[model samples]
Target: MNPDIVRWSYAAASGALLALAFPPYSVWPAAVLAPALLLRAMRRAETPQQAGDLGALAGFLFAALSMPWLRFVFGPFAAGLWAFFALGPALFGVLLKRLQGRGDWLWVAAAGVLWAGMEAARAHLPGLACPWLSLGYAFAPAGPLLQAASVIGLYGLSAAAVAGGAALALAAEGKRIPAGALAIVAGLAWGLGERRLELKPQGRPVSVALVQDESYDVERLAAMTPRDAELVVWPEYQAGVPGGMVDRYREHLAGLTSGRKGVLVVGAATVDEQAPFENFAWVLGSDGALLGRHDKQHPIPFMEGRLKGHSDPRPVATPLGPVGVQICYDLDFEDGSRRLASRGARILAVPNLDPASWGPLQHSQHSGMAPLRAVETGLWVAKAASSGDSMLIDPRGRVTARLGFAGRGVARGTALLSDGGLTPYVAWGWLVVPLSLLALAAAVADALFGALRERAFLVYPPSPLGVEAES
Candidate 1:
């Protein structure tokens, strides 16, 4: 059998396994196996270029398989998106090939760091920061491992996941001692996370109501909202009212909170002659007074046309407490939620708009990020989607209440405000981005230096007179 065929088969299988690790299928063990296979294939590659090609192949397959819903959003252009994102894994392969041969344990550690660094870079790539299907997200549904996010953040989880993969690859190659050590460390982390889950949130319990419907009808949503609840959340763009209609709807929306100590968080498109349209969440106090408006930050690239909101996100003071507001796409990233949590936000009210046309797969995947955010920031997330999957996630990443996909109704539940201090992630997890960038730069520099040194040797052979080769 040809060695190249076997290596490529490993790459292909890795991609398929990685896709299965994400939402909808969510085979957790596949997450560990996928990278193990990819690492094995890369180890067999004759050159860095071949290793990168294999990585690209696996990444492309993972993207195509895991995120087919992108086709509905981007038509045939979805292929370009997949190819673009695949570069992350390709670079990881190149770095791994260059950074190997240090030691088995060192190589495994580098693989993990390189994988996480690439993901961090992918999440912040200029206008194309799409952090979907990240390796860490594979554990979002796993109760025990999911708690680790509260301490290390998502990128740390990603590093640990790939490290486990690299260790598995080593074990397959007869390096059992180090592989067993890595497995023990992973088990310890999981055990710690499991124990951490037992810590209960100590804070005031508030009744929250999530009003969800396919039709972004203000009347219908208002009718469905529970007045008895202290906080009522509506989905994103629930009212696409222009400037003229804002005043009328403001009065009507205020009526929902009238005669009760309730706050209404409604998603609306603010359009007027003075400025471009914005995806805005309006917070209405019980007395019909406007509290604070949070414009959707981190708008979806290519798809969203609204002007990007530049103001820093903070919690909106309400009768219930300081409630943070975030639009649909904002929850996908960590910055907004972290900032809000740091600013003493007890509860986060998210207004999402995942339409049914996007498919249930998209809805499930998109909604999974909420739990990650909840765990990372120690905030109770009340996400109300227009089409479905409205949920109330506790600080520990537990889904206390949920309305499944394609269903339209109100999800009522009690959310405990975050009373404990900021989790470790909220305090220092942002360092992951900079640390990743620094590590990536160092790896690239090391690779370039090595290439240049090798080229110098090739350009000028070793001197016969005991003289070193000239530069």
Candidate 2:
């Protein structure tokens, strides 16, 4: 077969494999194999530019296969988003080709580091930066492997996987020792992760109810009593309760609150229509009083048109403990949740409303990530989604109870409440991103220096033994 044809085949296969690694399929091993295939294909590219082109093609294929849900969610604009995602992989290929050109000994390590750095950069790229499609997410189902996330966070797992894959690739290319060493490293990491799996639940217990109501009806609250739960949370933007309409819902909320002892967290669009509508998670007191409100700090871009995101995220005081609230996409970013956790938030209540059209694929993807937050902040996560996969995740990132998608019901569970101490991740998640950036800068500089040094050596070669003696 032609080398180009073979390379293209590998690229396409890798893309497909990566798509399968995510939700709906959740074939976790494919995540590692995907990058390994890509690395193998790029090894044949003669130039960095050619490698980048192949990467772009692979990325496009990956996006089209994996993220078909984006079209249903973002409409025609999904094309632009798909292209944006493809750019990261294209750059991934370019960096690999450039770094590999320098030498083989460090090429695999460099590629893995670059892969992680690219993922970090993509995550910080403002509106388009999606943390959902990250390579680490593929391992979310593997309980033992996910333990690595507690120390290095999600991006680090990606780096480790890519490194392992690259090592195996090198072995396939006739180097066996390095591959065996990398395998040992991977096994040790997994062993460490497994050790942490026996994490003891150490915190105050609190009962919570995650209500996934399609109608966002206040009437649903009639059944929830003080004995049922300490807090009841609804999914985000369940319905638009415009300004004039808010009074009626308030009346119903007041009735539900009277003589009760639990907090009712309602999600509704407090719409002004003329001004920017606020998507609020209103905390109604047990005695029919409005205690506090946490406006969604982060709204999904483009999908959430004209709704500006706010910066103030404080823990809401409840009968159980200080609870942190994140509305859907807010969980994607760490700032809001970390801030709340820092300020003594023991439990996290996330009100998510995923589209029914997106199906289990998107639901699984969204739900799988909540555990990372739980582990990162050492807080229990209670997520209520309007269209399924609602779950209660323990502090150790275990799913205790869950409701499947396309269902309408309340998921009742107990969440352990911490007194708010920073986990190592919360203290250090800020550092990983900067370090990744520096690593990327260092890689580029090294490549440039190597190229320059090669040119200098070519221009100023040492004289042959006899010629040097004459000189």
Candidate 3:
């Protein structure tokens, strides 16, 4: 809370601002938050030890704030995550201080490698592995920029971003070196890869209709009104609430269809009487009949046993071709999108809802990322956000149209932005292992063997030779 220590708090705010790129709100500009943190860390040392601690503080705040939603799973949520992010980064920052010196570029190099490795660590931490934004998101809107992910995977972009962030900090204080050069090369590679992918194009588009209904009313929609929906869609937890309360919304769903032959995809809190509560999407036929249903695969980390396996993406046979479903958080992961496209999905449908957390920047960020999914899959993805940005995207990561921010009860057309087949990214998964391994190796080496480097003297200065002068 002190003014001097307030810089750490500044780091936390920067992290939250960067997080606007994720769900509920999709503002990507929030990413500029990182550079501020990098700037703070690149400075004269009060003590090599203290400087390292500061760097660690910056890293932890960045990770923790960016992942505040994680508190929902741990229970008694809110503010508890501060300790985790605040105290956590101290360790790595301590290590970073050992590398700082005049004309030293390794300080930033180590920072980027360590940061990327840290992100990879959180991503693989089993119960905590949520790839909220693996750095690849920065280039999501630049369609050709992420084409390199097809071969190297998301971690490549993560390493590149880390290196870029760290190198920029050092370059501002000093000059360029391997770190800056590597970052430039990585950026160029993405451009080249994107250009190569551009040569191949899918044929045709599919017509789609997404329902942004608000009938759930903090309770079960089925139990609330005249049951009648041959085809309709709802948001996460909108159809059922307070447990075992879905019977109420059946009539509301039925009414949306009115006996017309159409697809009804509902995002609701689903209960099957005898089964455990689930956040599910119940797909209906042209006449209010059940066709196929898919549960969300990647529920928010920690919000499991309830929303667990609720956001899995899968394709269902439809007249417009096999339509795919990628619920709210599902689109955040590249695998879900790749899997659906691999399975012949030409029209992707994401039935997502975000009411409590809403902002203009947030919707724009989500819309920006949505097209990356579309272009990668070479299919049309209608991201229907009940309270956020509902958008239509084509195969080239281009948005045809989008619904505004938190537009309650607003319905609009996205025309038919569709295409066929799949991109190389869809054909490959976990292909980024090699790059991840390299980054991990660099991190481990620095952590264990950095004491032998010349920069160590800056952190732990050598004793001065003293000689007594004769009187």
Candidate 4:
């Protein structure tokens, strides 16, 4: 077949295999589909170059399909970055295919390096840098498979996922050694994920109500004030206007507070002459007194607060719990989540303001993280979006209750607050970035070793004849 035809086939197949990688969508398709595509590509490669080309095609299509929403993030830059990311998967598959002849373990390991490195780069490059389409998420409901993330972070889960695909390729080819080894690794990941689901240092439950205020018009909000609700929770950017609207807005808020029997966490803008206005989550008592306020630590890149000023989370005192708040795009970073989690925050509340993004896939792509953030920190994450995805996530990364898009609804669920508090991930936030660096270094060392053994190294320690001549 023509090389062009083959590339097209690779792209189409990989795109098709990604059917269930996003939410409200199941992964039975991806689990079987992805491996089948990989197996086909693995068998098709007669040479390393051919394998890489096939891999590249697969990567490109994956990027185009999975991240078309990025175009909204930074316009053409989205496609450009996705195109760049697509290469990593292709290069990974191609390299693993080449190394497969050596041994199946080497094939899996090499692919791990390639795939994980790309994800690492995605965090470093892509707009707001969301890597939500990770293969591990396809099995997010399968708690046993996701526990590896607590120790190694998302990359570990990714490496395991790729290893599974590589094993499937080897298995199809009748390569027993690689097949058995990969199966063992997959089993181990499952065991770890299973063990951690019920594993809690602080085993108790807390009541949490996630408010989904959906998107509302600022103009309409300005013209007509909102009615009061009990123990009110509002979305980010929807609470108060951009400038000094707090005092004017207090009356409407007071209506919710004065009669309400509990606390109200309002997402709004608070301003001072000293510095620019900050997006804040104001905690008000039922009597309408300001109880505590957590200023949104991380802000949206271009939309709300400046990224430079707001990357770090700043928490405040609240009776319900130590309230930790973040704006949209802030949830993408683990550090911000950790900062809030560290400060005695039992529940993670995000007052998200989601604008209509560029494409359809972006919405689902963003929704996927609710589980990951919950799983990684072992904290219940309540996302209150001005748009949607207002949901309650348990410590195990399951969406116990969720609200649909653009709806005024309350999702109440039993979210266990940390009785003892703080998981290793919360205390040790992406200490794995450095460790990933180390793992990557070791992987590079092994690759270099392979090159030396294969005589692919250009500078062979001087030939014996040359040494004799020198003597």
Candidate 2 Cα errors over 4 Å, as ranges: 101-105, 221-227, 239-241, 244-252, 441-471
RMSD of 3: 7.0
Q: Write the per-residue lDDT of candidate 4 for residues 1-471, one digit (tens) a residue.
A: 895576458556875576455554656337435745664676576766677677676667766766666677878777776677666666565545556666557766666656666566555543345455666566665677665656555666666666666667667677777668767866776777777776753544555565665445433332222223323456776664435556566666665335455556667764444557677777776676787666655444345534234555665565556656666666765667777777776667777766544333555556676666776776778776665777777777778877766555676666665546566677675665566555555655665677677675456654689788889
TM-scores for all candidates? 0.95, 0.89, 0.69, 0.76
Q: What is the lDDT of residue 68 in candidate 3?
A: 52
The numbered model that scores best in TM-score is: 1
Best by lDDT: 1
lDDT against the true structure, per candidate, is 0.87, 0.79, 0.57, 0.62
| True-vs-predicted CA distance for residue 302, candidate 4, Å | 6.2
What is candidate 2's lDDT per residue for 103-124, written digit by digit as tens? 6658877877788888888877
lDDT (0-100) at residue 407 of candidate 3?
A: 63
| Segments in model 3 whose C-alpha atoms lie over 4 Å from true places | 1-52, 60-77, 82-114, 124-126, 140-154, 170-202, 217-234, 241-259, 271-274, 301-305, 310-313, 357-369, 409-421, 433-471
Tens digits of per-residue lDDT for model 3, 156-209: 555555556666666655565754686577668767866765664445433444
RMSD to truth, every model: 2.4, 3.7, 7.0, 5.2
Compared with the true structure, the alpha-carbon lDDT of candidate 3 equals 0.57
